[model samples]
Target: MPVQFIKDPNQVGDAINESNTKPVVIHYWNPLMGEESPFLSLFHDADENLGPNVSLYVVDSGFINPPHDPQELPLTALYVDGKEKQSVPFNVDQVRDLIFSAV
Candidate 1:
């Protein structure tokens, strides 16, 4: 399925809770500096690896400027099932492996 765009923490929480049988990967990135951010590359790379058993959620926090460095915008990978499976610092190849492993 296509990635779902969630706007807040509550929406993320809801998605996590609602997704029971499949793995949910939340992609949080800044949309304001979207084309300029390294996350754009990472996001595309991750999307290419996504499969049917996985659900990808894209969330734009809208906190893209000062006080919130683009780097701080949760570039990590979260595997939310009954509880959070695991969270790690974002790495394109590593994340790709994780997604493939999940499926």
Candidate 2:
């Protein structure tokens, strides 16, 4: 499925609710990191490769705080049935594995 952009921090719960129907991959990005952030590109690539089994959501960390209070700038989290399963620091291979593992 296409990547869903979480425009507001308040919508985090909405994303979690959506996870009940399908696994959700939430990739947190700090806007201050700039538009050329590699993690952003990673997420786009993941969205293309992940197909329809999983839902990918992008959250702008510069404007909001993610669950678990992750210390990393770009955090990739896996949520299943409205509960978070794992959160990892941004990495091309790791993000790919995280998303695939959820399915």
Candidate 3:
């Protein structure tokens, strides 16, 4: 499926728990980073080759209190079977590997 945007901060949990059989990728980004952030490109690159069975989501980190430090402007998490497996700073290769390896 295509990458989905998390509109409500309250619904972040729901987005992560939405699928059970496939890997779920949640990208948390600060809007303050603007469109020029290198992290934004990493998110976009992963989205382009995302598998159909993978559930992808984008969250505006500013809208939600993320577990990691806000200074970590962009974070990407991988969830397997409705539970978080790993979270890391935005990196194109790492993100891509996280998704495909899980599949």
User: Highest TM-score: which candidate?
Assistant: 2
Candidate 2 clash pair list: 1-51
| Candidate 2 deviant stretches above 4 angstroms | 61-67
Model 2, poorest ten-residue lDDT window?
61-70
> Model 3: clashing residue pairs?
none
Candidate 2 overall lDDT versus native: 0.77
Q: Is candidate 2 or candidate 3 better by TM-score?
A: 2
What tens-digit string does per-residue lDDT give for candidate 2 at 1-103?
A: 7877876878878888888998998888777777644766666777788788888888875543444564576788888888888987867888878978877
* Best candidate, lDDT: 2
Local distance difference test scores for all models: 0.59, 0.77, 0.69
Candidate 1 TM-score versus the reference = 0.64
Model 3 CA deviation exceeding 4 Å by range: 36-50, 61-66
Which window of 10 residues has the lowest lDDT sum in candidate 1? 62-71
Question: Residue-wise lDDT of candidate 3 within 24-98, one digit each (tens)?
Answer: 877777778774335555456556776576777788746533566677757778877777788867677776677
Residues 7-40 of candidate 1 have per-residue lDDT tens digits of 6756767666654777776656666745343555
Better model by lDDT, 1 or 3? Answer: 3
